[model samples]
Target chain A: MSTAIRDDYLEKLIESWKKEASPVHSVSYLDQLREDALDRIESLRLPTIRDEEWRFTDISSLRSMPFPRASAAPLPGLDKQAGTFLDETACRLVFVDGQYMSGLSSLADDGSITVCSLSELIGTRASIAERYFGQLADFQENVFVALNTALMHDGVCIVIPAGVSVKVPVHILYVTSRKDVAVYPRCLLIAEPGANVTVVEEYVTLYEGASLTNAVTEMYIRDSACVNHIRVQRESSQAFHIANGSVLVAQSAHYDSVSLALGARISRFDQKIILAGGNAECEVDGLALIAGRQLADTHTFIDHANPHCRSRQLHKCIVDESAHGVFSGKIMVRPHAQQTDARQLNRNLLLSDKARMDTKPQLEIFADDVKCAHGATVGQLDNESLFYLRSRGLTEVAARNLLTYAFGGEVINRVIVPSLKQRLEEYILARTRIG
Target chain B: MINANSKVLLEVRDLHATVGGAEILKGVNLTVRSGEIHAIMGLNGSGKSTFAKVLAGHPSYEVTQGTVLFDGQDLSVLAPEERAQAGLFLAFQYPVEIPGVANDQFLRLAYNTVQGHRGKEELDPLEFDDFVREKMKLLKMNPDFLDRSVNEGFSGGEKKRNEILQMALLEPRLALLDETDSGLDIDALRIVANGVNQLSSKDNAMILVTHYQRLLDYIVPDYVHVMEAGRIIRTSGKELALALETHGYDWIHANDQATGAQP
Candidate 1:
């Protein structure tokens, strides 16, 4: 745990901020908040391997480099590169190199839904953005969130009215196309009471050079509302992606999230949820497929502050070649949160002898009348199944790849959207060499 | 069945296989010609399953000293998939549950691979579905099994039937069924035996490996071989199964010892 990496990066970041000055927004309070976030980042510094939350994942490599703020670049034929999930989405907000691309985005003019860039929202509906932004994700404890808060200039802001159920999903595509640069993308989502909506945030990079994407999303689910949040990270093989998200669920609210990681040289995602209301339900599903010198880590924390709440989490990883994966999930039941039920499971499959996985599923129950259980397992593919497939005329490689695809399909099958599921299946098949 | 013009489909000479450095098949020798069903019956731990697995090229078993010839080709040089493409099929006692792979897809892959090896035309999904449905009727398998994962969450009987369904689709020249009747009920045994009977023909051969004499009754064998300590010590006609059923395998062991044979 060396401070040299932090001091070096801190000086570079401060120098860049001095050159660019500060971002201008309609609300002066947000500018002050950004300054406060910068101060918070300075105080918190970057977490090293000594930190318990980052014990398995090392960030010294990220801190050692100088990733200046990425400038907007023209992405030719960007419209042709849109993914399969874009067609079925009701609305899509596209961003390239951390800058919003209005020409490529399809934002319908509808009064019931508010989907716009955070910068525009700051100028237009400053009051609404002022209420929800910077509320859920705590910048003081998380350095990535603090960095995103301090440096983010544009992102998506989604606000759904009360008692309305949106049938189609809304997607936000964060595409990067530069080398040796960093981008900060921030998202703020607010669902009023009884509102139901599904929001997907996808991160993909087109370039083959090393880049860093530090993103933070804050979601607020009001009383009795339902919100499904999905984060798909399919960045370039040379990219480094670090995302931090938080959800604040209100009384009887249901918040479900699925975080899928398929590419990156080094990727880490941390999501925290606070069950502040009684009878709140949260389901979190995650899947990471890493191979060939890649390291992907997922950390989640669910805090049950009220009684009669339930939380379920299932995270899986498929590691191959010299790649590594880490999963650390914790469920905390407060002293007064009686009758709380929580279950957590983490499963990993190592496809090669050189591949490795570290899993820690923890449960801290303080209440007496709570039911909590957690389990983790790491193993290779079943020998019987491999032999079975081989005996049926499949080559050894084909058998292994088929089993790997099957292992990953468990999480993809949970996606209710047929088109997204099909697209994800194709991605897995191509990556795992199933087809 | 005993004609001299019949061609030998499988020949095993002094087959000795080991798993984890422990020999399971100790000098097992067997020969089978086309158009014959030979039953290998023995007690538990007598290497019945090991022989079947070894013949099927299971990676766990190392053939320390053996030679298995399938249709005049040396089986030692081929991989498991190659052995399968060469028309050697084994019906496992416990079918594997491969989740996320539909039964129809698995069956089609196997069928196409075999067809490719034989230079036959492969069918598309819809055409194969129709063809497989007709074959499934022989085993009385429901059509829903095609959509489900291969053997995943299937009952014991259903798994056995699925194995038989695969056997029907493959149409191998030599088939080895390892304890296929162990976990099945009487009704399942009857249906499985009926399917085997329908699939048997003059152009193919079968080796039924089982512990019970009951399975032999349903699918009558031309010859019954008693395996003791991994070696076929006694070979007799089909009536030998009836004798073992009534007097048990211990009497044979006692007679072998009385005759001063190797214990």
Candidate 2:
């Protein structure tokens, strides 16, 4: 009944990591990956609030702050707020607190995509960074992804090449500079066979108090590849965001994702899509616009393992004021995944009345010639389509912000990225004119 | 021939309404002047679709006692979109469908929200696509239903000719219709009664709410009434809707509950 608490901030992070003097190239592989994340966080256990996947998300206000350990400083005027999706890019990976600035990154001038730094791909390609770092993230069953692989410094790797595609997209951005800081940022994308790419991950925050962002993204997508990922979290409302994305996809591959969680005071996003082969395709779309007292949690897993795979999930939430929205979507399939055509939809609107939405859509079909479906809906705002849009002269706050932007514009007009769907319809019409 | 100073619009009065708590319009009175059309009929719960969804501010019906007024203002303090931008219009017996919105952008946002409540100047989407292609050629509709969606997969006579092409592009001064020919078929109820008689004029006005008399034999109603258990016992003219379509509302619900009368 003892879970070792000999803490004084873990003895000042173990006497500042035994007076640091090694990392110039594998100090015993960073001391065996920080003693295997402190022996898997002192022998796995923490996940309390009655677990069921961290029931309604409670890390007791993130184990009461006190974060530190992310310092490389120099964030200075975030290069004029890193705009043109991080200025004239083809490849760009910035980071800032979770290390890797490499003088604000930029690579691909046609060497068929490699974009460095994960400590220069583990100090000069250590066997392709030991066959893909943390081999597709599990971190002994996530505790902020084992504290983001126990404070893994420097991220971004990206690969591409085999039958190349790469035309543009690749921007990575991270940010979060100090003030109660905690930034973990880790990303490793691979592609290969018949490769094609598009990735844009942007999470900001250089100031405006309180912070914590523990991110991890690992994607593979091989055979007949295609990947279009866009995660844009506009942090700092006194931040706290936890993001985890893992995708595998293989045969006849295609993996699509569009997640846009507007700011956070608390946010959780975990997306896992496996599919693993046979005509694989996964499309995930998400939009969140929570207001004051914000809390957004979106968890999705679509595994369908093999046989004629296909996965589509649409998530939309726009909870206002007393904001709180959580959507859990799962679609399994498996049994020799026959003709698996999975679909999951979660829709929520609830604009104030103490806004709240908790939608769960699950389908664990053991393929009987599968074609699974999962749906979740929590409503409000269709008082006959808000009196058919305020009898056509839209005023009740422009007909409830045009029917909550046409209910998250049916997954932001299924974004095929027209300048990120006109900057997510002008950031959801400036968050419905500040609610 | 409506024109005693050509206005009055909609009056209502003894109104009374209700839905799940039962009492469906029991004391109904009515007016609607300017270039009339009137109709009403009755039968199935004879509240004529709860007085056209309590004159279109349907919050699951519950008017519970009079006062509607209209053109001379006071519509129970507005709200069904400010009684549809103050000119009032109802249409639906079913209508809804709104999938992802576009039937010509919901009739150009209900004709620029009734031309921005009559102060005018709105049009744009290419002059609202040539003012909705001349009101979708007066309800013959189909310009590929202005790129689908609203009234979603249409048909029930293309959602009653897309509700008379949104009552001829929101030119309302009181429209109402309701069971707009419930599931039409006599050639889509004579093309949704000639697009509600070419958008009635003199200053617009109509009510209609049928139960049959074949949609007042194609919009020929200068007054019909009828209703039952919930007022309007029986008013006349348009040959009392061809005598309740050949004597039917069970002899006027047995002559108004056998003269303990209340029609």
Candidate 3:
């Protein structure tokens, strides 16, 4: 009887999502990709706690909710919402409810890079889209990625030309303003050989009711190219956010990313990075600050496929009230990848007796001459350290919050963007505030 | 700075304390007055450090039976921060290293908190920086030390010096120095001693917990007390520290058998 109800729910969800496709002149390649995604989604079902990877994260709440796709409607007072923008950078792309808003975004006209909304440049950049779109992030078995690929309305496309250095950072802002709505946001970035650029991906919401945001991002760095990706998610606590990011690092290329999960009722971030050539390096740092029944789950896979590669990862969580935080990081050094150095650490702070954290760091090194070290620690405030602070005239509550703020600050300080860094720091302080 | 008629600041009567259900302080009694410096000399298990921790209200140490009066107010009921706010300071033997908090920021916060409690005007960052720099000179600390995390990667002597540096900033009325001279070299000892001596005034009292008389050579104490088996069995002038250095603790254990018994 239970299986019958579950099967019926799956059929209903898929039927509702099929209509989310663009109702305009569709390109043949993208239509074929969408057909493939739809076929994959039909074979998969919503994950339960019984699955090994989903054991600690129970997304059953999302499976049973309404999956209504957002309709394109002009948002009132959008100009007044400019406060959500970062520093004055002309190179920004805006997407509201999975649809690109051309009037709300500005782009640098220097011609050093190509930034476009796939909806606007579908005719001219179809070749670029055909080469990389729906490629890095495999949707073979992942339902969320498959759904995003099948339903993405307007996707972000960035191309840094060869040997060009794009000094102006590009910002891709994803906004959700409707309740009971599911928004699928997509992005693809390709840095040519010896080219460099920075991209900021932000997910925010003006909706206070149950909402869903499924985002997919794919990045490719060519030989000697460098890319910095900073992803920030600060949605309403009543929203559910799931994101998948795939990156490929070429010979001697560098990838640096810092992702922060500060708000959400239930959020999961899945990232996979592949170092395809020798001497490729990547630094992936993440921080999740959740409280009051919120749950944040992060899973990362780094594959050192070539020789002489290095990967560094540090993920931290500050759990307060009855919130839960989960981290699972896997670093793999292929059999032939020698001289690969990898370090991964996950540290958690439990502020309340009911707060929970499940952290796992897995390192699989097949090379004989490789160095890989991983560690995870979950603890409350130190009694000795607390006493030391209280002895210095700080109240017990003040001392505890300070220590908690400092724990999350380690990752926040790594953000070189001054305004964003300060914003994250203040968010940590406010969340850890003691009454 | 000693005056026989100085006002009493801290008075402990029949104190008893246990750590992890093991009694470490038994029936210890002491009286401290303003304008005086007292040196406590003892062996490892003599409970001198435990007494200092209990006075500072360490959480691990439970006062099974005791009554402590700080400036004639019952000190047992107050919290550790309350004690600190009421002009009490303990220089930990092993100072803790706080990683993310800058040394200058921690010191300034502590100073301002204590100053606010005392109803004194608080100084801004510029003024406090100028003032603290002058105080750091007494301990021969570099200005860059303020920029680093509190005591993180500091040498043993540097940690001890930081303890004294805090002493100068807080200006507690009753200070307890718990083995502050243990990790110091000769040069560091001189600098620390000079700093403590300069912080001492006619309205403040300090008790130095040490195991050797060498510290007494630099910071001359007005009185010296010998603790044996959780009790102060002997109290005399500063000359007693010299006698204990030469005679060792063995002979004094035999003389204090009367008061050394566990209560």
Candidate 4:
């Protein structure tokens, strides 16, 4: 066992790294990278209640508890529970304790796409792995991100060749099977030029007790390519989850991502989409259902760096009991990014007096000739609408449930995949029951 | 069949209501006995709709000074839901579309709420399905309608018929039909009128509010009240409706002014 890691511990670690001799096998650049990460972790500070981004979500409870690093051990009793979350045709990649379990995974025999553990790729295909391993994500600036990047053991790597399209979705199931254990799971997806693919990433916890999952996903879409990404987070109520997704869109490419947040005691999702090429399009849609004393925060940034790019975002949230939900979406169009059309909308429904939701949709356009707009609304179910339903013979509870379901359903229904949409609908209905 | 001596169902004493700082109904009085249909005909802004809304406890309308007694209980003291559970139904002119609630679920909940208020046990979903099916048959509505979202994509005629179906399920002591004939075609009007006629009973009352006498032609009222401004100036039997139809509301207003009577 080791002493708990804190800010002082990070600082001490950085100080020791500056004086200690370099390891014998690793290259100079890799050693410097590790040292740089350690220095950044020492300098970067954790967000507190005073920070606006951390207003609704408090990490004090997490900081007080002792978190043990997840061991590279085989997980038992997961096969019984994993079958329900994965579809039949999905190329399932399973990971336990932040280590890929090849024996537990099932891949398509056809091999339209290459799927392997990040550690294996880093060892065998060092050049291809080195080019994108940690370029898109800036862990040094964020504490949880830095911690994950520092301790990440193994991850999932997916690559689709040029002009190739995979019909079946690739599934990455990351599960935490132990209590008081901390797992850092990473995933990197690279789609070559003119490639089309769909990826589904899910995060779940098998145990109901306390745990922590710090995960990051980086996706790179090349020229004229299309990628559909879906993320479903269903952690236990006693779990703390911090997830970050970074996407880079190339020339004339299209990127679509949908996130469903229905779990975790305290969850923070940070996503960024960079339009790096001309005539590119990006769409991000998300929904969150928070109940009990849970807190969920979703922050997104859409950076329009090129011309003739368009982006659309809509995030809906339903909060019940003493739950709190936060949404902060910012769309930025650079000065050279002319002819940009971007829109963002955030709507929230509060179901109880103790429940609260804070939404801020912001647009910062430096280009004079761009069309950008953002709007946010936080309100309860319309009284007139409720009475209207009740007058139609609905009970008060039934009327409220119907309206809430509809409010959340509007976003869920927009999912293009019929099977995924049906699953989401059933999940939402089940949550609405307790609400 | 509605019996003649079923007793009074609704009693209004100088009911006055205002909306947004403007007085709509000014000291208007009316009474409706069970088994009798009363017609309230008025031009636009004459407070006819306000009268219906006030009876249903709409929050927008403020009752300045008045008492509405429904089946021996004070209506003003009840919330909108409480008033609804008390057997008082108001068919809105523009029915609100609740996009997510199923039509059948809404109907069953409303029926059970009213039943619970009347000290009766609520029916289970199976029993309620049977109950609503019978009422749907009476309104000539398809069974598929029960599965659709409440009025989300319903036609104007369908919305009105759905309202009538709800009235049939609740079996209210008093039904206030507010502009129920608007946006309805001849066939829809006939069907709606027929449904209302079938739901009427000696132990229940009805007040039909409309601009035209066309609805009165189908659902004949025992009494007619012609309103001007915020007051009912003339009260007559079924024949006065014919007179008003033949001469228009202007003629009645002129006659009232000539006689120096307040409208």
Candidate 5:
């Protein structure tokens, strides 16, 4: 059976993929997964405004652009600027245009963890790669994820052994510098039982260029394992960024994911956490600060599949000028997932009259003995509060900026690492121009 | 104590202001002298709060015809912060709540801004914290109040005390207290009034805008004026406040009608 592709973007991407003549070592498992993803993309097609999930965010602009496929061409005389998490991390991995840059990365010789490129890992540790790759993320319904799985060539792979904890965070910097190029980057993380680790994945565009990044990440946490994942996206204002992150948590395991988006013409971050075992916990937090004509969207899902699970999520957005922001979150409690406690909140602050926000919080519970609550609020700065601050000798701009930063600070304050927290605060302050 | 011959700190002449296109203050005139604690007593809708807000240059109030001179400078030409820097302060009747900013940070920023404007050395956070703690003690405020967000989850009396605490820190030359004693209990009222009395000096002046004269008993204003229909119709010494307290504001309303005051 064959299905014809209707999506212009997919068709152009596939045509480019077929024309690739470079010799790349391929594993049978990933090849099959890629084939499956292509088939799924062909069947699903691109989502339009008719779809419920794509109602608020329009992709017509993306569909009109004929983005060229980017390869692993060496960036000549390209300079690498330090990232936000550069100072504290001993292990750092750098990627440019979806391909790993070996010269720019520094791998720690620590025995407790393993860090290598995905393509290298597929050759050296094929069994472990095959066991966990393409397991957590779903491509059947998510066209972006399917596109990423089909087109992605290489990314970062991290493995933490049992009963080991890395004191410092591992930083992965993904930089894009090509014009009108489409890039797909993938990441996979596996934490063994009793292991603990924190990872920071940052995406940035080096120059002012129009690019598309469809990234996917998968994580698996065994029993009693703890993992803190931070994803920061500060691409160019002319770029489009769409990312999907999926995590699987086992018994007594803990997973925390925080995503902060401060750039991009249009960006969307989708996060999913599956509590596969009892007594597991997950916390998902996000912040999006967009100005001018940019649009930032975030969607999160937490599934409580077993008993005694807890999930907490808080997402906030500060929009200025004519920018628009959207957030949709869902917390699901299965039939047998008794004693599940889940809460979700979304707050938005519109800085201009033309700014807009759409938020939806949903709770679907089948268990009778579960507690779940969800709320959403969209408002502008308080007039009285602004006046009060000005009365206390704060400039009008300073007063507005401070309140705006405080709105996003709720999510930033949850970070456990001090340096990262301080860096995030400064980054947010500079971006918001509060100082 | 105030001398009638002292320099005038604030002068409002023929002031007429509007809010949402409706005039609230009509031809109101008053003068505040240095070292004077004056009380403006009136009923609700008598434009008591509007008068205080207009003097603070609230954005919502538009002064159509009048001039407010502060230390002989046109107060109308200054922004709220500029007015605040030029020795003007207003303790809001309803203090705004800021949920995330700590009380200490807010106070220190205000203090530093005023200090900078005055060409004086500013205190860092550590030094300001110590100075503010001592001031808070004057209001009987707990040390924990410094760490919490400004007015967030604070009781009514606590909010009132926080407003006075700011008044003490700012040390403005012309301070306007708008119903600072309304929500406070007797004890909180005494503590807040005492704080205001301690901050009063011969170089500055205080204007207490309230509905009842009960607060005047504690602050001991040198002059008390009766405001009606957006203008001061009667002015007398502090003993007049006690007379009006015994008999409600109805007589003031009647006297205004008999004398054909502005409608």
Candidate 6:
């Protein structure tokens, strides 16, 4: 819709990217869908800062390089690190370089849920995939999702039957070990009527290398169903990560998500939630801790299409050492969507003089009887608070680190998985810990 | 219980300080000996609180002309934390709120730091919990306060009690109680005054900065000095506080006018 994305440089880059051969696949069931995505990719060009949606995020550096696909390889030193596995998880799915590693994964079938790779799931669950796959996440509006759909390898799929509730969370760990390569990660989750489940999707790196990760995730919750999604991306500083998440909530269904971005040279996460049925609800929260020339951007859009929908969101960022953080959250209440309650808040802490934060809260309300509120703030540490800590015998560095750590603790505490929460706490501490 | 080897803990010589290009504490002098408590009574904006903050090395206040020595060492050479580690404490008039940092953790760190500086053993979490709880009893604070964020959502009296609780834990050589009696009910005042009285000993001293003479009834000071216009206009025993309470401050201005001095 914007002319900025159609510039000559990006158009040439898009043409070159399209010329590259598609990823090899054996799943012939979705050949036509993949073909349709590839054709759509040809018409869409890369976005630049001049575009209204990407004014603060500059991705011209990505157009300068050609990141080819990589084949399956043994993960380097993953046996020692376990690739950040979480405790008390019902099932664990491991993907290395966009290829599913069955040897490193564990599956348990209790007859109430189904979790498997897309390839192996094609036989008996073909109907489930055919019905929900590529349904909610439209590729026409998003270039990253279209690219991911056109070149994705194997993906993880989880289906919860009706009238059943899953207690433990499902863990999906994506590991990046190859440098100078592009990896496409996909996830499809479907909660049937009255089903309930929790999922943790984490992207980590086994080595520090330059890479690109394009991720697309879709979640569908039917009537009275509930789902909790926790997505963590702590990739290497040399990596560029772009992810898109699309969610749909039915009548009386609930969806909650927590997205954390800790490490990435440049990262952008776009999340869209649609309350399609009456009385649907969602709680979306996020945190981004970055430093040393890193840039992290988050864009969220919540649509209240039906009456009696509620959306609550809080996004925070701790920027240090010349790092830049950006957040733009938009909530839309349609003309007929009465009784809609929406709230958004964005708070940022800039630790260094050069650290920067760009925050904006957009509310588009067409219904006169709806309720909506939004606020944003950016500031440094309070001098009085710092002196108060110092007066009590704490060093200045220790005081600063403690305050910075506490700023992020509010979002990290929302994680339900114990081991994962502990890991995240440790991660934040290590980042803010004084030498 | 006085530490006889180093009796005189603080000596402020003609202290002149300015904040935001305006002088607050001008030409003030005082000496505090171990085992002695002094009360500085003054009206609002008379620089009593500024004097305490200056001694505690607050970054905002600048000592334009002054010499402060603590135990024969120049106080200007130490940073705020270093001064704190050197056994100097200042209870803030308005306790700062530090959200998300638990009171127990902050108290233990402050205790262990000063203890380490004094060559004492550091306590673990369990040990610190027991030790802090015993000290919290001095102020009659609830055990739930230990888990709350420091001064966050605390009532005015609770904040004042937390300050005194910290004083009991640190056991500083010289404690500057800056308006600690403000914003406290009579019951909270008695509890805070009793806690301060218990924390004081012959080995340590205190300088109570207050506006009213009501607090003097609970903690009887050895000396009381009336401050006016950034300087101590009169120095006398505790009777002077009662005299000021009864006679009011009008006679001081009359005396200042008679002596040809600024009121």
- Which parts of model 3 have CA positions greater than 4 angstroms off? A1-10, A18-25, A75-83, A122-124, B254-263
Q: Could you estimate the TM-score for every candidate?
A: 0.95, 0.37, 0.94, 0.82, 0.90, 0.94
Question: In model 5, which regions exceed 4 Å deviation?
Answer: A1-4, A21-25, A73-83, A122-125, B21-23, B64-66, B119-147, B185-190, B211-214, B242-263
lDDT of 1 at A45: 72
Full candidate order by DockQ, most accurate first: 1, 6, 3, 5, 4, 2
lDDT (10s digit) by residue, model 4, range A1-435: 133335764544334433534332343333445555655676676688888877767787776544666765786656776234455445879988788888778887787888888666545455666777677887767877776666565688888889899888888889888788788898989999999988888888888988989898999999999999988888999899998899999999999988989899999999999999999999899989999998989999999999999999989899999999999998999999999999999989999999989887888889999888888888998988877765544556766877888888767766666667777777876776623
Q: A17-118 in candidate 3: lDDT tens per residue?
A: 655555344777877887787777767787888998889999888866767778657776765774477784668898899888888888889788989987
For candidate 2, the TM-score of chain A alone versus the native chain A is 0.33
In terms of DockQ, which candidate is strongest?
Answer: 1
| Model 2 C-alpha lDDT per residue in residues A360-381, reported as the tens digit of each score | 7889888799778878888888
As a whole number from 0 to 100, the lDDT of residue A269 in candidate 1 is 93
lDDT of 1 at B95: 98
Clashing residue pairs in candidate 6 are: none
Q: Give the clashing residue pairs of candidate 1, or none.
A: none
Q: Which whole-number lDDT from 0 to 100 does residue B237 have in model 4?
A: 85
Expressed as tens digits, the lDDT of each residue in B95-158 for candidate 6 is 9988767789889988987888889999999999999999888888999999998999999999
Chain B TM-score, one value per candidate, order as shown? 0.97, 0.37, 0.95, 0.94, 0.96, 0.95
Ten contiguous residues with the weakest lDDT in model 2 chain A: A5-14
| DockQ-based class of model 4 | acceptable
Listed per candidate, the RMSD to the true structure in angstroms reads 2.7, 21.3, 3.1, 5.1, 3.4, 3.1
Per-candidate interface DockQ score? 0.73, 0.21, 0.66, 0.34, 0.61, 0.67
Per-residue accuracy of model 6 over A272-375 as CA lDDT, tens digit each? 99999999999999999999999999999999999999999999999999999999999999999999999999999999999999988999999989889999
In the range B1-263, model 3's lDDT, one tens digit per residue, is 67879899999999999999999988988999999899998999899999998998889999989789999999889889899999999999989888777799889988988899999988898999998999999889998999898899999899999999998999999999999999788999999999999998999999999999999998899989989889898888998898888878776665456557532
Docking model 5 quality class = medium
Q: Tell me the spans in candidate 6 whose CA falls farther than 4 Å from its real position.
A: A1-25, A76-79, B1-6, B255-263
